[model samples]
Target: MANASSAATLSICSSSSSSFFSHIPTRVPSQFSFNHQKPKCRLLTIRAAVYTAPSPTPMPAASSSGIVLVDKSDSDKVNRLKSVYLEKIVPILKEEFGYNNIHEVPGIEKIVVNCGMGDAEQNSKGLEATIKDLSLITGQRPVKTRAKKSIASFKLREGTTVGIAVTLRGNVMYSFLDRLINLGFPRTRDFQGVNPNSFDGHGNYSIGMRDQSVFPEIRYEALGKTRGMDVCITTSANTDNEAQRLLALLGMPFKEGAGPTVLLRRKRKKAHHFDSKIKGKK
Candidate 1:
């Protein structure tokens, strides 16, 4: 009986141990479990792209004398009036004036083109048109001329734009002069010659054009209104005689019998007539 009882106790203990082992979960190995296993990484090979720049075209080499021999097609041609002045006018003036040196011969210093707009403050479009026309006439850009002081009579305020002007020098001056002489004057109506009395006492000449349409650059149909312009030619000449002579040689057409001597005589006669009237009144 004792042997049988001990055997029964051993069987019960074995059954309980087997049931506890079944309730506890078994763990998978770290190498084979998806949750703990690391994935194999593969190395990728990439190739870099190479770029090459094209070579530049060779430029014409300069000569030993420091002169670059450029093709005529590639270079800007010289101005015709400038060439004439250098080759022809200079030598003629030197002989005619009996100048001691070539530098002593009077030449044009600059040209000032002015267009006054009394109603610029009121007519903004006119002012803009004037600026555009002036710019077209002169190759250079036009600058606004502002009123220096307020004028009650004219209703002009200080710093208000009253006019536009352009000062041309160098090659541009020569080109403008050439065009004015060759094209502008010839296009004017009933034009015999320019006024001989328009020279200032200080070797400068002024020309007033009644119509801006005289210039070929201006389109008559496009104009909002007709405008006038004043052209003042400044020269290096010491006296009016020298300046007038210079201009005459350069194809400036002066009125017949309107020389400096004739103008001087007319001035003297006017002065004498005024003196006679004063004496008679006394």
Candidate 2:
């Protein structure tokens, strides 16, 4: 049973539809007398066994890197506003992106994910604790986040087929958007949906933050120090086009740029007033 358990824990994260890699190395220019060193050949078969399941193929040249997927899991929103990288986000990337060399080795190496809470001091303590929590769970020093936003985001690298995160979410995301207008920032209101071109046909997507200052904490130079929050979400496709197709099938807004520009996508807030007597003598 111990042996069986070990093997089960080591299963590849594929859909069981595919898993095979092969290579035959042929010598190049062996006849040159001055070049006496024999060429080295490699034959390896590393299955689709990263934290997330990856598509099957020969290991890519070492030059390419993978992406890390993140999902914010902190809010009572029941999966909204929380910062986390789910086990499944990886498989989705594998199925969509064609990085045979990708991996899912786990660790929690970055950022807080809670949507609402205390001020900067409390936020700092919480973030440090959360980073420790991730490290403990994954059995290694956590990887750096691709983008950290609010307190509920942490992710891996880009374009490597790892799970980064899809967490520009929740009512808070909308709330933060609201503050943007009051602060006199230029932005499109009633944002019906993000551009689906952010992902590819297979189901992988990337979230690009147009302006990080939209978040109050990010812009707070003294009270809060923001992280670099730009991320590239890699899916199962080798390119962005395929990931966008998959997101479209999922009801994601692909070309909502389709509607007329005249109708703004928001409703104006009604004015409110409070009655109170002044303390100063008339």
Candidate 3:
């Protein structure tokens, strides 16, 4: 019985090995040569499987040095402002504010456009439409903002997309600002200048728009939803006065005499000793 089992195992092993070898493709000779001199000669020589790789195709040539490459230039607003600064603003600032160096003049750093989609939590499609509208207005894709913490009152959940924002800087920021000042603001309903008191003490100015339709990109009939947006312009100035001056020079229209100092003085004052003197005389 033991001899019979051993013979069966050997036969099974041989059959399995033969089956495995059968799956492998037969190798063909890699090299072949023919005698061109003797056209009638028949050749069946199987040379060693040496691989002779095909030559690689050559790469395309680069543009010539003489051809001028178009690169990003300073935005129209930036260029115009620079020229204005050199020709007018610098001298005016020097005469008025006693700023000795051109570097002392405040400059805009960045502008942030934020739009909150209140209906997004109820309908996700609203958020998408808001994103498209914002992208069209700013000429940049917005980053969707999500809720940081769950709120039971607002039905807001953590990680829920609630708003979209675009932060503009450098040339893009300047260009957007130019459009906002020249185009967008003019299209606004009331047509009043922006309030001068919107600047934070740290030289950052914030503007609130009632309707997104003021921007030319949004058509009144095509709007999926009416949304308000906040535009914050951050400046390199240390004080609100400096920032106000910088924005004003860049053609940001502010209400007449609504300067920072004037707004501070307009606050309600406490009853003075003049009232006590009048009471005493009475």
Candidate 4:
């Protein structure tokens, strides 16, 4: 009777254990896994901490491209040359020179400013000062001109930088010419106007300045030594006469009755006077 009671108690304990184990979950959900088979590539979904509206800001308009419309503006000012050309020059060209087409009217193409750096080869300060003054005057940096061939007599070596030059075009060229004509020429010592015969017969005029100090760009005290420069103005005209007329109309301040024509007339008058005196003596 004792053995049977013991056996029955053991069976009851085993059944209770089996029931408890069955109630427990044996498999984990896919969300939480420790198995490392072929790894899954799942994108994580995250929500923002704060709520905000989706608004796109507008951008500024892009600049118009092309050669002609680059600097076009409502506030664009007509400079002295352009003003005179439109108001006075065009009509004069049409009436006096028989220029029927607007394109035939002479206009300035460019202005070239050059300075010799012969002294700069010896002193670095000279080049610096020249560059500074030139940049101030032209509102542009200069390109150094180098010697192509060595010259033993002048002690110049090949590839040696001997000069600096700046080419002015568009508005800068016009402004420079305006200043040169209105202010620079008047400030020159003795104040003789530019030579009319300096035109290269192809609508280009070259003028030489003996002293750069004449320009307001160069301060007298700051200069170590005086320097000279050359100014070359190129025009779209076909001939020297047309370019000369264009320049004069644009206020170049050419000397009155001091040109080659005037000189020739004077020479003819002298010759005639001499001939009359000889006839009287006879």
lDDT of each: 0.82, 0.36, 0.77, 0.77
Best by TM-score: 1
Q: Per model, how many backbone clashes are there?
A: 0, 41, 0, 0
Of 2 and 3, which scores higher on TM-score?
A: 3
lDDT per residue for candidate 1 within 65-105, as digits (tens), equals 32223345433545666665665567767887798999998
TM-score on alpha carbons, each prediction:
0.65, 0.23, 0.62, 0.63
Off by over 4 Å in 1: 1-78, 261-282
Clashing pairs in 1: none
Model 4 misplaced regions, further than 4 Å = 1-78, 260-282
Candidate 3 accuracy as lDDT: 0.77
lDDT of 3 by residue, 199-231 (tens): 778999999998888888888899865789999
Local error of candidate 3 at residue 14 (angstroms) = 99
Candidate rank order under TM-score: 1, 4, 3, 2
Number of the top candidate by lDDT? 1
TM-score of 1: 0.65
lDDT, candidate 4, equals 0.77
Candidate 4 collision pairs: none
lDDT of 4 at 235: 94
- Residue ranges of candidate 2 with Cα displaced over 4 Å: 1-192, 196-204, 210-223, 226-228, 238-241, 257-282
RMSD in Å for candidate 1, one decimal?
18.0
